[model samples]
Target: MTPSRVIGYVRLSRESADSTSIVRQRQIIQSTADSRGWDLVDVVEDIDVSASKRRLDRPGLSRVRAMIAGEEVEAVLVWKLDRLARSVVDFGTLLDEGINVVSCTEPLDTTSAMGRAMAEVLQVFAVLEARTIGDRLRSSIAYRVGQGDRWRGGPTPYGYRSVRHESGDGKTLEIDPSEAAYIRQAAEIVLAGGSLYSAMQAIREAGSKPRRAEAWSISSLRVVLTGDSALGRQSRHGVPIRDEAGVLVAPWEPILTVEESERLRAILAPRPLTETRRKASRLLSGLLVCETCGSRLRVNSRRTAGAQVESYGCRANGDGRVCERPASVNADQVETFLVDEFLAVVGALPVVERREVIRDVAGIAEVEEAIRHVTDSMREPGADLGALVAQLGTLTESRDALASRPAEPTIEVVESGETYAERWARSGVDERRAVLESVLTGPVPVKAIGRGYRRMDAERVAAPWAWLDEAAADFVDPYWTD
Candidate 1:
């Protein structure tokens, strides 16, 4: 007799305290699999993801669907029916796919009429529970807003902190500073017809780092300038709300003055939708160059017969140049090749060597020490101090000028290994992007080949030398091979 094919599915809502904690879900699924005498083929888990019955953002659910479509699995086991789905529509669709679902804790079996009815009822309850939780959160937020309290959640925007402030009841809520000097500078640059990129550079030149140790980017600076707290206001759905309206209010401490806020807003208010399209086009677009014309390749995406296809092509040949290259290369294929090759390259290096290299290069304390020494030298008094001060002022002016400019194009390497993966998991997307840029040297080149496929021309660019690179490559090469 063949063993029953079973795949365990687990989903946790981001709002739930234990939604994505693997230990709890794994224990429950493992116990159930042990009792049922079913062969567990795979375990799909998505963390900090929502179980929206009306939505399909759950990665675990998508995995399950793929398993069923490929006929790779016969049945799916879940801790409960709610684990499988929270929406009646999604539940019905899953049943239609003919994959049996078993809820270990609930009397949910898709095989029988009574079981199906019970599953529907359970789904209704789950949806209701999800809605109730959402409503409660919103209500709590509204209540806090009515009291003129700010919700201090997520990372505090750059140049701001969640600090205790005196409330009417003598409790404290987090607020920004009265003269958000960095924020004001950012606004001034933007209003003076400076680009957002330049404004961020200016902020950095002024020796201003984010509340976190990370350098500021245009996106981060934009978030700060447009943030409700920066404007000394509170907002919900982009609409400014008053405390009396029972909407969540930002803790009132003026950062940028009203005039500054208005000026920044004016700069951001108008844009052709094409600007966004152009930006989307340029993500990783700069990584590829036409071998013939040496022009950067452009990315184009379109839907064909319910499937979307993306390709990179030479923009220079649009006017009818005899370019031997194909019109485009498959973007998916290009990405997959790059990712696979990149991973292979990474895996080829010894973990210890990589760590040592990272440790040697990422000497944050050393950089800080250099900054301190420079600062100290500027502060000391002597006859030569006057001349030194002038030099220091010139350096400061240069640094500030550089800071106010947009960042130059650069490639960064992201350290990989168990430790690096753990840190990446905890980091925000922007933070991760910054870390990647810091360690990798780039102008990552892509070459289009046959049938809309592209390969990364790894030879064209050099990898950033970490401390490990400083050591003899011969010593590291032998260990890596062994």
Candidate 2:
């Protein structure tokens, strides 16, 4: 004489909506089970999910079906018929398996013919109600957006955070100060002529990450940097959605100015990949900039008396008369001078200045990344080599261009009185590279002294940072020449 087993089910479309709350629905089903003397198996609930979708759409509904199929329950109980299903087809399928259906709130049960008729009639109203609600919600959001209202829900975009007021009007958007700093730095780096790749590296070096991704990815950075969001304008589906007066409405202050945004956009804009660049054969390839023609110094290795001597040659000489600067500097000589200069000065700078140097290092990394990207594009299948060459000409020019010279940082603190040189001498390749890059922009230029012998002198090396500059020329990049 065991009581008949039954499983209860409930659904609440909106978490805040009070008409059909989970607690209320559970009370009704539990009471119904108590009165009918049916052994309650379990209560399945779909929170904040609409009943208008297919039965398969509701995880709770699917769970209930499996429970009944496993003979865990012989009947299903719900606060209302629509809670189980809004469609009459789904309504029939719920009872198709010979499991009786009961609606506690509705004056109906599947055991009687008249009850089935009333249940179907109630389903029509339920479906109509759900559709009406969905339509109203859509119109309301569209109206709010048209009115230039702030987006009310969803995660905050990059460089922003959600701010909730105590008055409970709902959360508003605000610039996340620390995260916003990265965005500002990005715009500055690019405005000062750094690429998106450089911006990404700078951001990571500065210790900021995007909201979603682990590290600054190319695709993610493109979406964040190129959009109107950088200007603080609200966007929908990745594009800035305009307001009634045709103005871009932003809930929070913009991270970048309009001019800055446009400049960034121009820099980020798509270009034809035509620079026929081969993979870097040397560690310092594309990092070195020529003071004469401002062209990239390509890596060249030649045999001299059965020993190989590596040198960085002017682009003009390598590519059939592109530059008047045929001068090549010994690679080892330049690298050692630059590294020595970095170790001597960088570690003694103020911690804050050290941090700035790291950011610039990231910027340098970004420029190198841009070069790699351009090189990759030119090598893609069916690339227009001629067109790509022209495009690469511009992109690679920007990539090889040196950042502004860093000021001579006054030395203050010395840990254990150890010079940066001592630390460099003891450090590994990776540590040495980081230390060097953090202080001076890469590929120390060894301009020939008086255009005489190709004597690689430390006094002739020009670094963006004062730490590496043996001679402070503060020279601007000469116009890219043939």
Candidate 3:
């Protein structure tokens, strides 16, 4: 009688770290096949793939399934049952296909009823172990985050480079002055109303290169501009991580101030489809609101009697819910009016920079180090537990006191010495928009004017900036002045 044909499957979680794992599994499968008097057709492999997490998309496993479906093999051989699948749902899927799975080290023989029952029990424990390992890893990362340790896992950010920590076990980010200079230049260009491609040109001129690609692209430049790493803040999955004190957790010195970061984000934010396609070329594209339908005013251009007239009209006119009296005004006139109004209001106010003050109080770093020393000493064999306990208590008290202290952040007001009119000449649309947004609480309402009225009406445009109180001066950040 001919021996049954069987295929061997192997998987390794980390291919580079565990070179011997694949070899070991292959040897076990070959030896088992010889002992069982089965014809070993071929061995398939999936390197650096985890069984518990990436179970469905394994190429080698797909080949095994194809062979089983084609009746090319009577049985599938693995070093262990978990190597086939860590989850019951995955293993049950294979069992329901009526394919016999034989494990070299485990008693997972899908042909027998008792063996199938045993396989289910073992799969449950495998899933539990995978989850427990995941939990421990997440807990370890959380502890590190709380301790203000930078994660050295992924690629280092553009403006920063990884360096060995002073204590020497882990890595920390340090501002690379050469690369960081380019970040500053790029931000300045964007803030000054220059395009991202223009910033890319500036970065290239400074002899700075991007991290991954050979040359910098606009998208990559935008990523660097908007990343939390530029603000010296730690983030996971695009969300900033805050400490227990509610302050953003910063491990390294900042490349950009919080105000600069906020302004860059605002400037680089995506415009609406209508604005982008038609190009909001005007300064007040999204800022104007129709008083009738409460919709934003979008720029519209029409050639009336051989002259191309650009105007800002109610967007609701095209959105199926037409405004009863759609507001329309010449684009150039309304922008000029709003700018003049904004400048007349708070444009001369000295922009105050509000920043969180940082101080090293109560020797918190020293206290934490002392606590770590005491905790380590307590773990030593035949150590003095009583003395170590006393030291730890004293260190903990000092640390708590430092943490509990309320942070007194003072507003630093720096006078730019330049009035609004003087800075307005040097500013771009983005800078002007930032200024307008800081003064106005919401969209400015534009009431409809009489048809064919060529004269610009100041009454038609409502100024939210004029209504703002003096206390609103707190919202202003030095833009063109800086």
Candidate 4:
């Protein structure tokens, strides 16, 4: 007589499960199929996968479900019902679909009413066992974490090495200073007003190893700086199982301080991953700010004199009522100024400075200018120029207030192996912008005074940090303001 075709399904939740276990399950399933005069049309095996994951995420289980849904097999045979699903509800869903289930280890089968009832009861037991095992595992880990014990298994996070426990029971993670240096540098860069992109450059300049091959990359540094691992916290499957109060469950020391890690998190929380910048044509493309109106100076290009010309311009002052700054500064002209100014200021500093430079240039006036500019537009203009006159008065107040404020403290930079000129020449646009950003207070405000309009003067170019610290303030009265 011909045998009925069936689908053989096997699952060993852990990939580390012994091969003999799989052979035994297959053998038992085959033996039962033969005795029942059934032939397995196809055998599906899920190795190293867990019922803990969703069924769709598991390839073998998904294939088996699809097979069953299509009614391609007369019956589903497994070593045990738990091999199919740890959840009884999931198993019941199969029975509800009018598909027959048979387990080689259990005496349960869907062939008869009594057998079907036994199968469901066995599934219920299987689910209960699975849940009990999960609970016990969670409890064990929580206890281990609460006790401040090291992780017994698994890979340690980057920047840390693991050593066997003193008792030889497990392993503890220890900080690897060489690797830790890179992580600390990343955190400091972000805290110093540098973006993740800047961190990538600094790592490259430091000759630090990247998680990826060759030079450093954003995704690599991102996981380190923006994760709890940097804070000496441990996790698995990207999930935080327990906080375990008062316990520092990390077997290794962290690369960043608790405060530094918190600051990075706060800064990173609101910003989307898409915030990474793409390559731009000019060096200071988005870095330029209008000290006058508090608007970012945009790089606008136009076709003039039969060639493409690019310059930085402000949109708010298009009406020419709010700002006293220049209408537009030449792109090549500004970049030359930045490169020259960068060399003058940063060039004199030591070649290799400290691991981190402090960023203290305040944009208080710039921020206030931004707010005032927006608020001034709230009122409807009168038939006359009253609103305009009122807004102009507000702009003058901002300008005068900013002028009266004391000089901002200079950004102190230590020597890094290379001079600013060398680094600037070697770096890309984003990196150059980062170096410029770390030192400059806000945007390079361009004031058009008969003040050497021909040559971009540094004094008129208002940088928060001096080009070389008080070179006889050369423009107004004895202050020699430009």
In TM-score terms, which candidate is top?
A: 4
lDDT of 3 at 331: 90
**Candidate 1 lDDT for residue 37:** 80
Q: How many clashes show up per model?
A: 9, 11, 0, 15
Best by lDDT: 3
Clashes of 2: 11
Q: Name model 3 segments beyond 4 Å from true.
A: 1-3, 17-20, 149-154, 167-171, 204-209, 276-482
* Arranged by lDDT, best first: 3, 4, 2, 1
Local distance difference test, each candidate:
0.60, 0.66, 0.78, 0.67
Model 4: per-residue Cα lDDT at residue 120: 82
Error of 2 at 283 (Å): 5.9
Least accurate 10 contiguous residues by lDDT in model 1: 354-363
As for candidate 1, its clashing pairs are 201-403, 201-404, 202-403, 202-404, 411-440, 412-437, 412-440, 413-439, 413-440
What tens-digit string does per-residue lDDT give for candidate 3 at 35-82? 988999999999889887787679999999999899999888999988
Q: What CA RMSD would candidate 3 show?
A: 12.8
lDDT of 1 at 440: 40
- Per-residue lDDT over 1-482 for candidate 2, one digit per residue giving the tens place of the 0 to 100 score: 23389899988777874464788889988998999888998998788887775454789888888887888887789888877888867777776765567888778887777877787788888878878987998776665455444554566778888776445545557788888888887776566444577778878988887777788886788777777666667766555664332234565677876555666778888766875655534445556777777777777889999999988877676567565545578888777766665445554533222112222422343345445655676779997777657655765565456455353445442232334444344444444455444445455565644445655455566777743356645732111110
Superior candidate under lDDT, 1 versus 2: 2
**Which TM-score value belongs to model 1?**
0.48
The superposed Cα distance between candidate 3 and the true structure at residue 325, in angstroms, equals 43
TM-score of model number 4 = 0.59
lDDT of 4 by residue, 330-396 (tens): 8898788767866764565545443333332243333343445445445646433555456556656
Candidate 1 segments whose C-alpha is farther than 4 A from its true place:
1-3, 15-20, 149-159, 163-179, 188-198, 210-214, 226-228, 242-251, 266-482
